[model samples]
Target: MNHNQQSTDGIHEDDAALSEFLASLMDYTPTIPDELVEHYLAKSGFQCPDVRLIRLVAVATQKFVAEVATDALQQCKARQTTVVKDKRDKQQKYGVNVKHQEYFADSPSTGMDPASRDE
Candidate 1:
């Protein structure tokens, strides 16, 4: 194979392109959710297990993390937007600065106990 020849991929990547790709990979960190981690661990089906098995699970999960994260982000945004919309709807329905008297119910003590005072 010639040094400057185009590889099977069809595009001839120079050293700079390869270097840039490698550099980008260095900064690439997959954001896997805790739920996925738990699911993977549970699917492995073991107590105090082998390191190789753990590594295998991690490697397998790495491929799906990007897709999972993208979907999770979309769901999160939808949930948050719904919550905000619900809050606004409630506020509008009840009127602005609405305060329930039950929330400010009478308390037993103001600050200190009655017997503790040096009166």
Candidate 2:
């Protein structure tokens, strides 16, 4: 679908594109044009331009934080699924963790008993 198309949820594809663009802007200088800034300032009904800009930045920051939090939760869910009975299965499915092999051990009891080992 094109950017102008409206989805079942009533949000236009352009809205999503705009949101993505704005999120990317947060990563750089966020050099919004003065005319666009003035437009938003006027639409916001705020008398002071400084306060309007502050509120706009605050909203953008909040949106970015929420998106990051949601992504983290999704990653946690995917990681949780890697929990299986066999170590080889987990390794085969999720690959080995060379940095921390113990984290993906097939069995927690697989660790050697230091007490039983004769020094």
Candidate 3:
């Protein structure tokens, strides 16, 4: 599943996390050198070295994204076992709400009853 060039399983949800991913790209994978990458950028009239780093980083990033995505998929599938569910049955799962939910008791049966809604 380590198809780095593929689109579906290729990328990670967080693109920013890729640069810090394990293993260097140029060292492990086929890619341009950092110096050459900068050369191309400079030849193209780009001034910032950081911008060049961005390009090299993309390749460096692929390895981690692949590793993470595969691990995540495996973990999720592993959680699907009946044994896991049996254990979870005794555990109460809590749902978090980021937004307030409106509540009312015996509030109304319709948008408005003219008599009841009138101030």
Task: Give per-residue CA lDDT, model 1, range 24-110, as digits (tens).
Answer: 544444345434555667777754344334444444577677679899999999999999999999988977666665544256454
Candidate 3, 11-90: lDDT as tens digits? 65445465654334334533445566566667878766464354555465555678899999998888778667866765
Q: Per-prediction RMSD in angstroms?
A: 17.3, 18.7, 20.3
The order by descending TM-score is 2, 1, 3
On TM-score, who's better, 1 or 2? Answer: 2
Local lDDT at 119 for model 1: 48
Off by over 4 Å in 1: 1-61, 96-119
TM-score of the candidate numbered 1? 0.31
Q: Give the lDDT of residue 36 in candidate 1.
A: 57
Q: Write the per-residue lDDT of candidate 2 for residues 8-40, one digit (tens) a residue.
A: 335656688767766665454433444565566
CA-RMSD of model 3: 20.3
Error of 3 at 34 (Å): 13
Off by over 4 Å in 3: 1-55, 82-119
Pairs that collide in candidate 3 are: none
Clash totals in order: 0, 1, 0
Model 3 scores a C-alpha lDDT of 0.60
Candidate 1 Cα lDDT to native:
0.61
Residue pairs of candidate 1 with colliding backbone atoms: none
